[model samples]
Target chain A: EAGVAQSPRYKIIEKRQSVAFWCNPISGHATLYWYQQILGQGPKLLIQFQNNGVVDDSQLPKDRFSAERLKGVDSTLKIQPAKLEDSAVYLCASSLGPEAWETQYFGPGTRLLVL
Target chain B: AQSVSQHNHHVILSEAASLELGCNYSYGGTVNLFWYVQYPGQHLQLLLKYFSGDPLVKGIKGFEAEFIKSKFSFNLRKPSVQWSDTAEYFCAVFSNQGGKLIFGQGTELSVKP
Candidate 1:
C-alpha cells in the first residue's frame, strides 16, 4: 500500500503571487487533512475533509486560502496573494475514517517560501 | 479548542542513555492521544497511540508513552536510546467529539555516539 503523496516538494513565490499544492492520500482512505507547519513549530490544522465534504476548516484563512477535494480521492490547497507569513511547509494527511482512534498517514509536505 | 504542549524544544544525549520527553494537553474531555516521529527529511510516522484501555502504550522502535488521564499528560520514553533514534517527536490529541488532531510544538532529539 502506498503512503500519502504530495507534489512539488518545494515551492517559491513572491508576495501577492498565488500558489497551489496537491496531495494524493493512501488508497481507500476516506478522510484527508491539510496542515501548515511554520519553522520551529509543530503543524497546525488548516482544513479537513471527509470524502468530498469538508469536516472542518476553522483555521483556514478564508480571504486568501481555499481548498477542494474533488472526487474525494485527490485534493488541492491554494493560497492567493501569498504573504511572507505564508512561508511554511504544507502537509497533507489521510486516515481510514473520521473516528478519533483512526491513524492518520502523512505526506512528505510541500515547503513554500514567499518572497 | 484544544492545545498540546511539549516542554522540551531540544535535547542531546549520548547513545544508550535513558530518554524522556514531556507532553501536556489541555482538554477536559476524553481524547485519543498520539506520538509521531519525523526523521530528517522524512514524513511524520506514528510512534504510538493511546485510545481507551491501556495507560502504557508501546510503539515501534522501542518507543513507549504513558497516558495519565488524571494529569492530562502523555510522556514518551525509551529505556536505551540509539543514534538512529534522533528525530523530532510530536505529541497530538484528537478530541472524542470530532475534527482534526491538535499537535504540540515538537521536541528535537539528538543522540551522540
Candidate 2:
C-alpha cells in the first residue's frame, strides 16, 4: 500500500507572498491531518478533516490559513500573505479512521521557507 | 491547553547502550499516547502507542513505552539500541474528547558504532 502523498517537496518565497500545498491521503483512509513543524519543535496540528468534513481546526490561523478536502480524497492548505514565521515543514497524515486507536501515516512533507 | 513535553533535546550513545526517553503530558481527561521516530530524510513513523490495559506497550524495532497514568507520563525505552536507531523522536498525545493530536519538541538521538 502506498503512503500519503504531498506535492512540492520544497518551496521558497518572500514574506507577504502566498503559498499553497497539496496532499493526497492513502487509499481507504477516512481522516486527514495537516501539521506544521518549525525548526526544533514538534509538528503542530493545523487542521483535520474527516471525509470532507472538518473535524478540528482550532489551531489554524483563520485570518491567513485555509484548508479544504475536496471529494474527501485530496486536500489543499493555503497561506495568504505569509510571514517569516510561516517558514516550516508542512506535513500531511492520514488514518484509517478517526478512532483513537488508529495509527496515522505521514507524508514526506513540504518544506516552505519564507524569506 | 493540552501539551506534550519531551525532556531531552538530544542524546548520544554508543551501540548496544540502553535507551530511555522521557515524555510527559498535561491532560485531565483520557488520552492516547504515541511515540514517533523520524530518521534522516525520512517521514515520521510510529514507534509505539498506549491506549489502555497494560502500561508497557511494545512497538516496532525493539522499542517500548511505559505509560504511567498517575504521573501523566509515557516514556520510551530500548534495551539495546543500534546505530540505525539514531533519529529524531517525538512524543505525542491525542485527546479522546477533542480529537486532536499534540506533539512535543523532538529529541535527536545519535548513536556511534
Candidate 3:
C-alpha cells in the first residue's frame, strides 16, 4: 500500500555535470515510467518499462539520458552532461500492468536545476 | 503525433463558484481519457477516467468530466468548488494500443476561501 518512492527530492548541478535519480515503485506493480516535466508544462514520457524489459523509450535522449530497471522493482534515470534545458522535474510512475485502463500511481518528483 | 491541450493556464474564482476546465486531444484512434489532480506539494492523483460507456464520469471530490469522442475533448467540471479544490489539473490520454499516457500542459485553479 505504499506510494511510489523517489530519492533526493531536489538536486542542483552545473551544466555539463551528471545527475541521477532513483525510484521505488509500488509493490507488485509491473510497469514503470519516467517522465520529464519542464516548468509550466505537462510531463513528457522519457521511457517506459514493463518489468525488466523496456516497452518504449522513443523520446529518450540517447546521447545524454539513460535509464534502467534491473530487478523490475526499482529504477534509475541518469542524465550526463546536463544542459540548462534539462532543468525540470523528473517524475516516476508505476501501474499494475500495461493495460490502457490501468491506473498509474506517481511519486513525488525530483526537481533538478542546472546552473 | 499525439498531443493534449489545456486551454486555460491559470484560473481564480471565489469559493462555491462553478468551475469548468477545457481539454482537447489530437488522436483519431480509440483512447482512454484521464483527469489527474495535483495538490500543492503532492504527487499527481487520478481524479477520474473514461474508458467506455458513459460520457459523463464522476470522480472523487465531486469532480466530473465529460468525454466527447467526436470533438476529442474531455473537460473537467465541478458544480460547486471549494478552496480545498484548488490544484493543478492535467488531462491525459492512452491509446488502446499503448499504455503510455500523453498529458496536457495543465490548468492551475485557485479558489479563494
Candidate 4:
C-alpha cells in the first residue's frame, strides 16, 4: 500500500513570510497528525485530527500555525508570519485509528527553511 | 509533562558490530512504546512497537526492542548491524490518557564498511 503523501519536499522563506504545506494521508486512515522536527531533535506533534474534527492542537502555536483536514482525507498546515524558529521538517502521519497502540505511517515531510 | 529521552545523540560503529540504543520515557500511567527509523532522504518508518503481552519485540531489518516497564525504558538492539543501518532512530511514547505521542531526541547511527 502507498504511504502518506506530502507536497513540496522543501521550502525556503524569510521571516514573517507565509508558507503552507500539504499532506494526504493513507486511504482509509482515520487519524492524521502534523509534527515538527527540528534539527537534532525528534518530531513534535503540532496537531492531530480524527476525520474532519481535531483531536488535539494543544501543542500548536495558534498565533502562527493553523492546520485543517477538510473532507477527512487531505490536510494542509499553514504558517503565517513564519519565524526563524519555524525552520524544521514538517511531518505528516496517519494511523488506522486514534487508539494509542495503533501504528502510524509517516510521509517524506516538507523541510522548511526560514531566513 | 510526559517526555522521552534517548541516551546517545550520535554513535559510530563498524559493520558487523552489535548495536544498542537506549530510550527512556516518563509517564505515570499505561503507555505504548515505539521505535522509528529514518534513512537518508526517506520518511520515518516503524522499526518496532511494544504494547503488551511481550517484553521483547522484533521488527523489520534485523532490529528488535525490549520494553522494561520497571525502568521506563524501551531500548533498540541489533545483533550485527550493517552499513545500511546508518540512519536516525527515534523513540516515542504514547498514552491513552494523555492523547498524544511524545518523541525523544533522535540518535544518529553511522556505520562504516
Candidate 5:
C-alpha cells in the first residue's frame, strides 16, 4: 500500500506572495488532516477532513489560509499573501477512520520558506 | 483549552545510554496518548500508544511509555539508545469526545555512536 503523498517537497516565496501545497492521502483512508510545523515545534493541526467534508478547521487562518479536499481523495492548502511567520513545514496525514486511537500515516511534508 | 508539553527540547547521549522523555497534558478527561518519531528527512511514524487498560505500553523498536493518570504524564523510555534512534519525538493526546489530537512541542534526541 502506498503512503500519503505530498507535492513540491520544498518551496520558497517572498512575503505577500501566494503559495499552495497539495496532498494525496492513502487509499481507503477516511480521515485527512493538514498540519503546520514551525522550526523546533511539533506539528499543529490546521484542518481536518472526513471524506469530502471538513470536520474541523478552528485553527486555520481564515483571512489568508484555505484548504479543500475535493472528491475525498486529494487536498490542497493555500496561503494567500504569505507572511514570514508562515515559513514552516506543511504535513498531510491520513487515517483509516475517525477513531481517537487510530494511527495516522503522514507524508514527507512540504517545507515552505517565506522571505 | 487542551495542551501538551514536553519537558525537554533537545537531548544528546552516547550509544547504549538510557533515555527518557517527559510529556504532560492539561485536559481533565478521558484521553488517548501517542508517541510519534520523525527521523531526518522522514515522515512521522507511530512509536506507541496508550488507550486504556495497562498503564505501561510497549511500542515498536524496543520503546515503552508509562501513563500516569494522576500526574497527567506519559513518558517515553528506552533502556539502551542506538545511533539510529536519533530523531524528533512528539507526544500527542486526543480527547475521548473528539478525534483530533493536541501535540507537545517536540523533543529532539541525538544519539552519538
Candidate 6:
C-alpha cells in the first residue's frame, strides 16, 4: 500500500546542464504521469504512460525533454540543456487505470532549481 | 484544449471562519472536475471530484464543491475552517477519457488560529 515514490527530493544544476528525475509508481498501479509545477502554479502534465507505452505526451517538450517508462514499473524524465524556465517541481503520479474516474496518487516531487 | 482559472491566489482568515475559493474552467462539452489539496511540503491529494450526477459533491476534510454548468464554475467551500486547513488548493479538469488534466494556477489558504 505504498504511495508513489520519487528520488532526489531537490536538485540544483547550472544552465545548459542535463538533469534527470526518477519516479516509482505505487504497487499494482497501471498508469503513470509526470507533471511540472512551477512556483505559484498548479502541476502541468508533461507526459503520461500506460503500461510501458506512452498514452499522451503532446505537452512534453520534444526538443529537450524526454521520458521513458521501461518495464512499466519505474520511469525517468530527463531534460537536456536545462534552462532557467525549466526550474520547477517534477511530480510523479500513479493510478489504478487510465480511466477518467480513477483516483491518482502523487509523490513528494523533485524540486529542480536551474541556475 | 482546456484551461482552468482560480479567482484568488492567496487568502488568509482566522480559524472558525467560512472559506470559499473560486474556480472556473473553459470546456463546452461534457467534463469532469476535481479539487486537490496540498499541505505544506506535502504531495497533492484529492479533496473531491465531480463526474456528472450531483452538481454538489462533498469531499474529505469537510470540503465540498458545487459545479455550476451554466457558469462553468466549481467553487470549493468549507463551513468552518481550522488552522489545520491551511494549504494550497488546485482545480483541474478533464474533457475526455485518458486525457491529461488541465489545472489552474493554485490558491494558497492560510488559517490563523
lDDT of 1 by residue, A9-110 (tens): 999999999999999999999999999999999999999999999989999999999999999999999999899999999999999998887898999999
The candidate 5 chain A region of ten consecutive residues with least summed lDDT is A95-104
Total clashing pairs for each candidate = 0, 0, 0, 0, 0, 0
lDDT of 6 at B81: 100
Per-candidate Cα lDDT values, in order, are 0.95, 0.95, 0.95, 0.95, 0.95, 0.94
- Writing each residue's lDDT as its tens digit, candidate 1 over B9-78 gives 9999999999999999999898889999999989999999998897999999999999998899999999
Model 6 chain A worst lDDT run, 10 consecutive residues: A96-105
What is the TM-score of candidate 1?
0.98
Estimate, for each residue in B1-113, the C-alpha lDDT of model 4 and write its tens digit: 89999999999999999999999999968999999999998889988888898899999999999998889999999999999999999999998778888999999999999
- Cα deviation at A3, candidate 4, in Å, is 1.6
Misplaced by over 4 Å in model 6 are none
Residues A33-73, candidate 3, lDDT per residue (tens digit)? 99999999999999999999999999999899999999888
**lDDT for each residue of candidate 3 in B36-94, tens digit (9 for 90 to 100):** 99999999999999999999999999999999989999999999999999899999999
- Taking all chains together, each candidate's TM-score versus the true structure is 0.98, 0.98, 0.98, 0.98, 0.98, 0.98
Off by over 4 Å in 3: B97-99
Residue A41 in candidate 1, Cα distance off native in Å = 1.1
lDDT at B65, model 5: 100
- Candidate 4, backbone clash total: 0
Question: What interface-residue Cα RMSD does candidate 3 give after superposition?
Answer: 0.9
Across residues A1-115, which tens digit of lDDT does each residue of candidate 2 receive?
9999999999999999999999999999999999999999999999999999999899999999999999999999999989999999999999989888899999999999999
DockQ value of candidate 4? 0.91
**TM of chain B, each:** 0.97, 0.97, 0.97, 0.98, 0.97, 0.96
> Tens-digit lDDT track for model 5 on A1-115?
9999999999999999999999999999999999999998889999999999999999999999999999999999999989999999999999998788778999999999999
Pull out the clashing pairs in model 5.
none
For model 5, how does the per-residue alpha-carbon lDDT over B1-113 read when each residue is reduced to its tens digit?
88999999999999999999999999989999999999998899999999999999999999999999999999999999999999999999999766588889999999999
- Superposed Cα deviation of residue A45, candidate 4 (Å): 0.4
